[model samples]
Every structure is written in structure tokens, then in C-alpha cells.
Target: MKSEYILKTEEDTKNMAKEIAFDIKNKIIFLNGEIGAGKTTFTKYLVEAFGLKDEVCSPTFALENRYETENGLIIHFDLYRLKSEEELDMIGFYDTLKENATILIEWADKFNIEKYIKKYNIISFKIEDNNIRAVTIK
Candidate 1:
């Protein structure tokens, strides 16, 4: 399944994330976008939708961050700084997949992990000029 949304403001992104958070069954989501894209912003709203009050920050340096919510754990990962596949193993990336938690990965396109994951969703964000963003989910 795939859908697209034109986000004109931060509120639009928040609503979209909230909708996806409630509707999507797939816990593993791959966030594809470049720097300055709304990946982190969307993530913040998604976490909020999950009933989490903890602040959400990019795990660019920390590799990953985990937030426990009423539903379950929401693990957000950023592969932007990962140097190699071996680093993934070192960071216990594969191990996390085995757990019963919602997983969101940024820079997932850095490596081909689709074969390893049985079920997942891909959400791509594209910046259209200064105030508009095109978000597509599959």
C-alpha cells in the first residue's frame, strides 16, 4: 500500500504522523530523506502519538534511541554516521529487530536490509521549494 501527502505546515506533518501511528500495523518503518528534510519532525509527532512525552532527538551520534510508551518501545535509529555493516552488528541493530517494538530507521537506504526484515514500511520525504514537502508512504 502507498499514499502521498502534501505537507504545507508543521501541523500537517504532525497530523500525518499521528494518522500513520494509529493506522499502520507494520512496526518497522524506513524513513528516507536528506538533510533538512522533515524526518525528525515527523518522528517527534509519531512518538507523541504513541503517548510518549520524552523528547525525541536525532540519533545521528548515539546511533539509536529508545522510548517506552503505553503501546510498546519505539526505537529510533539513524544510520547516517554508521561506517560499515560490521558497525550494525556492533550496535545490535539486528538484535533489536527481533524484539517486539516499533522500529523507525533514518538513512535506511544506506544499506539493503529489506531481505532481512519480513515486514516493513517505507516513508519518503521530499522537500518541494521552501514551505512545501511531499511525503510518500508505502
Candidate 2:
């Protein structure tokens, strides 16, 4: 499935995230975009919709973060700083998918995830203007 939305403001982005949170099935999510394209921001709202009280921050340096939600665990990974695909192996990337959790990966381009992407949703963020974003899903 593919969908596109124009977010003129942060609120629009939030609304889109909320809708996706409830609509998207439990599967891996690959977020693709530039550094400031709001990939992390979109995941933040999705986590919020899952009943997380604390703020959601990117796992840039940490590599990953986990949020326990009523539905299940939400595993968010940022491979932006990953130097090689071997790092994913060291970090137990496949083990993560084996678990019963919703996985979302930012900077997924670091490695070839095509084999694991069949059941996943891909969301690409593009900055149209300041605070304006073009969000597309595939």
C-alpha cells in the first residue's frame, strides 16, 4: 500500500502519525529521508500514540531504543552512524525481527534490507519548505 500526505505544519504531521499508528499493521518499518526530513519526528508521534508518556528521541548515538506499549514493544533503530552492515550483525539485527515487536528503522539505507522488507512499510519524508513536509508511504 502507498499513501502520500502534505504536512503544512507540525500538527498535520502528528495527525498523520496518529492515523498510521492505528492503521498500520505490526511489521517492520523503514524510514528513509535526509538528515532533517522528520523521520525521527514521525516515529515520535507513532510512539506517543502507543501510550508512551515520555518523549521519544532518536537513537542516533545509542543505536536503538525500545518502548513498551499496550500493543507490544516498539523497537526504534537509527543506523545513521553505522559504518558497515557487519555492525548490524554485531547488534543482532535479525534477532530483533524475531521478537514480537513493531520495528522502525531510520537510515535503513546503511544496509540492504530488501530481504526483510517484504512485510514492512516504507515511509519517506521530504522537506518541502521550512516546517512543511511531504510524507509518502509504500
Candidate 3:
């Protein structure tokens, strides 16, 4: 079941993330958006909604950030700096998928989307206007 939502500001984006968080269960979510878009902001709210107390930030430099929540672990990945899919293997990407965790990936376009199609709920974010964003889920 796919869905679409419109967010007018950062707050709206966060709220939308919270709503989506409730429906997720051991799933993967791919967040696609441009720089300065609300991907990280949405992720922060999603983590919070999962009852995580730690701060949520972009993993651009760190590559990935893992948070342990009451439900399970949440793995956030930023592929902006990744040179190739081969690097994912070196970093134990497949190992992460072995766990019953929720994964949210940013800059997912850099990777092969088909690899995760069966296990992921894809969310694509697009700027509709200066203060508005359209998020589509499939």
C-alpha cells in the first residue's frame, strides 16, 4: 500500500515521519531528497517516535549511525560520499540487514534500489516550493 503526503515546513515533515513510524515494523525506508531537504529532520522525528532518546543527525561524515531503541535498532545510512556499492560490502552493510532492525537510508539513489525493493518501503522527497515538500511512499 503506497501513500503520499505534503509537508509545508520542518514541523510538518516531522509529524509525517511520526505517523509513518507507527506503521513500520522491521522494515527499511529509503529517503531520497536534495541537500537542505528535510530528510534528517524527518529521521529525527521517526527515531523519537520509536522511543529513542539519543540525538539523530546526518551520517554523511560517519557514513552510518546506529541507535538502539526499545523496539529494536535503527540504522541510518548516508551514501552521499560512498564511492561505490563495493564499499557497502566492506562496511558490513549486509550484516546490518541480518538483524531485525529498522533501516532508514538517505541518498539512496546512489545505490541500487532494486536490491532492497522487496524489503523496503521507499520514500521519495521532493521540494514543492520554498516551504513545501511532497513525500511519496511506495
Candidate 4:
């Protein structure tokens, strides 16, 4: 099953994240969207809802960022720079899934979906306008 939502601004995005926070537990969330789509912004809201006080930024350069939260740990991964599945293995990608943590991965299309089958909840975002975005959850 899938659900869709339209967000008109940053606040709308945060509100949506708040709603999702109630149901998200130690699960992996795959975020798929184009550049400038608001994936990072949505993640920031989710992390904040989880009680993170520090700034939340994209892990594009660092590859991953780990945030400690009351619920557990939230691992944010940016796979934009990763070139191959071998590289992902070298970095212990598979092992991360075994940990008791919530994962939010950006640019998830870069990885093979087979590896995450039945292990993740996938969400896709599309920019509808300068201030509006359509989010789909599956």
C-alpha cells in the first residue's frame, strides 16, 4: 500500500514528518528524489522530531551522519558519491542494517533495491512548485 501527501512549504513538510514519527520505529527509510527536492529538509524535520538538538545537514560529503535520538540512533546516508556495490560493501553497508537504528538514506536509487528488499519503507518526493512538493510513501 502507498500514501501520498502534498506539502506547500517547509512547515507543511515538518508537520508531515511529525505524523510519520509516531509510526516509524527501528526501520529503514529510503528517500528517492532529484536534486533540490527537499529530501534533506524532510529528514531534518524527522530528526528534530526524534529530539535531535544540533543542526541536521546533508551527509553528501561525509557519506553518512549518525544522530543519537531518544528512539534510538538515526543514520542518514547520502549515496550520491558511491560508485559501486563493492564500495558499499567495503564501507560496511550491510552491517549497518543489523544495528538497532532507524536509517534514512538519500539518493537511494544508487544502490541495488534487491539488497533492501523487505527491509525498508520507501518514500519518494517530487517538487510540484517553488514551495510545494508531493510525497509518496510505499
Candidate 5:
């Protein structure tokens, strides 16, 4: 099953994120969308909802970032620059999935790690014509 929402502005998107936060915890979330699709922005709101004390930024160049909260931990990953699946293997991505932390990945549509990614949530971000964004979750 899935749900879709039209977020007309950044604020609308954040509100949607808040709604999603209620259903998630220590789960893997794959963010799929093109560049400038607000993947990172939604990520920030989600992280904040979890009570992260610091700022949240895209792990674009850093590849990945880990944040701690009083309740648990969250790990954000950017796989846009990865040249090959071997690169992911080098980063111990598989092992990371076993850890006790919530995982959110930007540019996740690039990988075919279906076996490992199964049984997780998938968020698809789509840019609309009127400067709005369409977000779908399954």
C-alpha cells in the first residue's frame, strides 16, 4: 500500500514529514528523486522530528553522516557519486544496514540492492509543474 501528497511549499513538505515520523523508527528509508527534488529538505524535517539537536545537511560530498538523538540514532547516506556497486561494498553498506539506527538514503534509486533493501520504506519525490512537489510513500 502507498500514500501520496502534494506539498505546495517547503512548509507543507515539513508537515508531511512530521506525519511520517509517527510511523517510523529504526527503519530503512530509501529516498528516490532527481536532483533539487527536496529529498534533503524532507530529510532535515524528519531528523528534527526525532529530536536531533544539531543541524542536518545533505551528505552529498561527505557520502554519509550519523546523528545521535536521545531515543536512537539516524544515518543519512548520499550515493549519487558512487561509480559502482563495488564502491558501496567498500563502504560496508551491507553491514551498516544491520546496525541499530534509522537509515535514510538520498539518490537511492541508483542502486539495485533489492535483496538487502527489501522490507523497508520507500519515499519517492517528484517535482511538479507549478513549483510544487509530489511525495509518495510505500
Candidate 6:
């Protein structure tokens, strides 16, 4: 199943994130979007919806950020800096999947991650006009 949302303001993005968070069940979510398309913003809201008070930031430099919440463990990964699939192993990507956690990966489409991950939720963000974002979840 697929769902689409139009995020015109920060409130819309926050509401969408809260709604989506309820559906995450030890799943991997692949976030697809260009820079400034609201991926990180939505992630911040999603983490908040999970009752986590920790600050959420893009892990572009560190590669991965782990959050331990009352709901469960949430791992956010940014694969933009990764040059090869081997680096995923170095980052313990596969090992992390074995844990009972919700995984959100940014720039996941950069690699052939679908081959390894059979089950996942793909949330794609497209810039429509005047900073409006069209987000689709599948």
C-alpha cells in the first residue's frame, strides 16, 4: 500500500511524521529526497513522536546515529558519504538490522540496498513549488 501527503508547512510535516511513526514496527524506512527537501525535518518530528527528547541531526559525517527511546531503538543512517557497499559492512549495517529497532536511511537509493533489504518502507519527497513538498510512502 502507498500513501501520499502534501507538506505545506512545518505543522503538516510534523503531523505526517506523527502519523507515520505509529506504523513503524521494527522496520526499515528508506528516505529518498534531494537536499532541503525536508527529510531531516520529518525525521526530527518522527523521533519526537516516538517520545525521544534527544536532539536529532543528520548523520552525514558520522554515518549513523542511534537513539534509545521508551518505544524502542531507532537508528538513523546517512549513506551519502559512503563510496562502496563494503563500507556498509564496516558501519555494521547488517548487524544493526538484526536488532529490534526502526531504521531510517537517508540516501539509501545511492546504493543497491534493495537487493539486501527485502522489506522496507520507501518514503520519497519531491519538491513541488514554493518550498511545498510532496511526500509519498510505500
By lDDT, the best candidate is 6
For model 1, how does the per-residue alpha-carbon lDDT over 38-105 read when each residue is reduced to its tens digit?
99999888889888877899999998998888867889999999877788989999999888888999
Note each model's CA RMSD in angstroms: 1.4, 1.6, 1.7, 1.7, 1.5, 1.3
Q: Write the per-residue lDDT of candidate 6 for residues 12-110, one digit (tens) a residue.
A: 999998887879757999999999898889888888999897799999999999888778888899998999989999989888877789999999998
**Which residues of candidate 5, in runs, are more than 4 Å off?**
none
- The numbered model that scores best in TM-score is 6
In model 1, the Cα lDDT at residue 11 comes to 98
lDDT of each: 0.87, 0.83, 0.82, 0.84, 0.86, 0.89
lDDT of 1 at 49: 89
Candidate 6: count the clashes. 0
Clash pairs, candidate 2, are none
What's model 5's lDDT at 29? 90
What shift in Å separates residue 99 of candidate 1 from its native position after superposition? Answer: 1.0
Model 4 per-residue lDDT tens digits across residues 14-122: 9888889757668888899998888899889988889886799999999889999886798988999999888888888778877888888888787785555566887
Please count the clashing residue pairs in each candidate, in the order shown.
0, 0, 0, 0, 0, 0
Cα lDDT for residue 46, candidate 1: 86
Over 4-72, each residue of candidate 2 has an lDDT whose tens digit, in order, gives 999887788788888888666467889999998888888888888888766889999999999998766
Candidate scoring better on TM-score of 2 and 5: 5
Preferred candidate (lDDT higher): 4 or 5: 5
Model 4 Cα shift for residue 48 (angstroms) = 0.7
Which pairs clash in the backbone of model 3? none
Rank order (by TM-score, best first)? 6, 1, 5, 4, 2, 3
Candidate 1 runs further than 4 Å off: none
lDDT of 5: 0.86
